[model samples]
Target: MRPTVHDIAAAAGVSLATVDRVLNQRPGVRHVTREKVEAAIRELGYIRDVAAANLAKGRTYSLVFILPASDNSFMYGLNAEIRQAILRSPAERTDIRTIEVPAFDPAALVSVLEELSREKPCGIAMVATDAPEVRAIVDRLVRAGFPIVTLVSDLTGSLRHHYAGVDNIAAGRTAARLLGRFLGPRKGEIAVLAGSMLVRDHRERLEGFTSVMAEEFPDLTILPVLEGRDDPEIAHMLVADALSRNAGIIGVYSLGAGNRGLIRALKEKAVDRTLTVIAHELTAHTRAALLDHTIDAILNQDAGHEVRSAVRVLKAKADGLAVIEAQERIRLDIFLKDNLP
Candidate 1:
């Protein structure tokens, strides 16, 4: 069996990113790490010809960014990042176009994917809706020899070439731990606001949050998840309603976008009670809330980094080159009022 980069990563006890850096002769690696990877390569008798691989697959990429038509600040930031990538695409030898489908609408997204499949671009990157039909379309695209990369929200059980997003389960677990510590040992109910359970990212975050809360903070009970559809008005209404009904709800875990609404609802009830809020994204609204002590912590994934990473993955898959998994791994940034950038 031909040893792959995955095998090298395991043997060296290092990340794929380090292996790629070594294989491609890129900078940014410690001397000890480089020696370990080289030793592993020698032991396995492995050879890498990145130049030959690139020669076989010439550059000139046609990539598509299929994003949701969400009004939230996070989606806005994502689109902005894509635009920035487009500006830089010429030098990278890549051409990029973007399409927006209705947020949370499985049928709408399916129609768009089908249309793109016929065109057969070099690669397709999308924020997938977690529906069986959507998954089937992605599988079809992959089978048709198109490189499909899922961005932000992933499509599980599909033949996706790569995923450019954070580990949502870990994000949720972190949120739970922070909320538990902030709330102390007081007995109270917690409200979780999500975009929808249909998206894999949100579901994973919920699972992580619930599991950790149950194991560590028994006193903090998680209430039923409220689907806000990433809409500010909807989220605001749901939060207002939840707060009114359960006075014991002292903490909130917002696992999705639409935090503007959450902020509005919290502001309205800020005088009545200060709900310890931990939400995703570091948008203007969230930053303001954090500064004023309306929100305790902000869990963020860089929208710009995610878009650029997806582009790189798509280009690599199109060129039949290996991806640096560690380099492409999207980081989860934890933001506090003190550290606002």
Candidate 2:
């Protein structure tokens, strides 16, 4: 049989109340008594059931999610998933709330993080901006005992507890391979569309895409990245202008949001030209584009899965328990027209 609190108390020559205080790290137990109880726990291999104890105490974990205020299908999908998680909050013993900050705004994100540090929720998850200031604030908050997780977009170098998102570099590399294979023996320029270089995910994707293209497909020249800020109108204007100006452009790789604009641009500008296009996210626009052969392939990370993983990791961190890494690992899902689900 497993050792219980009673066994710990008996082995430590302490009362039940004393053992409880020590186990919960609550005040009132003397240092010596705490040490004795800890020693007994180590000796007897006593494991505290954190879930049962929290349930008995009626403990509710308050968690905050910080998202970018980007007007795009991917962001909309992510918000919908968060809303679904909110609907299930009662059963999960979580109080989940979301805060939106302007996309690519480092100062605004830092201010929000500072405020959240003061509010001191049980855990925090954010689609990080990937700026030095943001990373500094995150590191400080983690040092101050906040269980922080990076969602969707991760911080490059920080003390964030976990990242509940796909490997963006791998996703980008996959996009390159798909586009390269689709464009078979062609020797023309490839245009890249992005939200912004400020976010780590976009930067990493661009890095992977460029490295693979340079190494394997030396015939394909990559044009300068068109930064659309993840806005449909901006992406449309930029992509349309790029295609109009560059007649040699043979492929499009959109490793970011704003596929709506990319699709519209491709339809309007590349009417006579046969441009192989690959994009991210499987939204309504992208799905239709894929069916119509406007897009050759799509690489996606499930918004619902990412949100759920964030909540699970946060809850486990709040309860002082270890999370199964394999369970929390979010995989990249590649979708073509035939594989759409």
Q: Name the candidate that leads on lDDT.
A: 2
lDDT of 2 by residue, 1-341 (tens): 98999999999999999999998789998888899999999999999877688789898889999998986788889999999999999998989999999988999999999999889999999999878899999999989989999999888689999999989899888888888888899999999999888768898999989989998999899999999988889999999999999999999999888888899999999989999999989999999999999998888999999999999999888777899999899999988899999
**Model 1 alpha-carbon drift over 4 Å, by segment:** 1-59
lDDT of 1 by residue, 264-289 (tens): 99998756786799999999899999
- Looking at candidate 2, the ten consecutive residues that score lowest on lDDT are 48-57
TM-score winner among the candidates? 2
Candidate 1 matches the true fold with a TM-score of 0.80
Alpha-carbon local distance difference test for all models: 0.90, 0.92
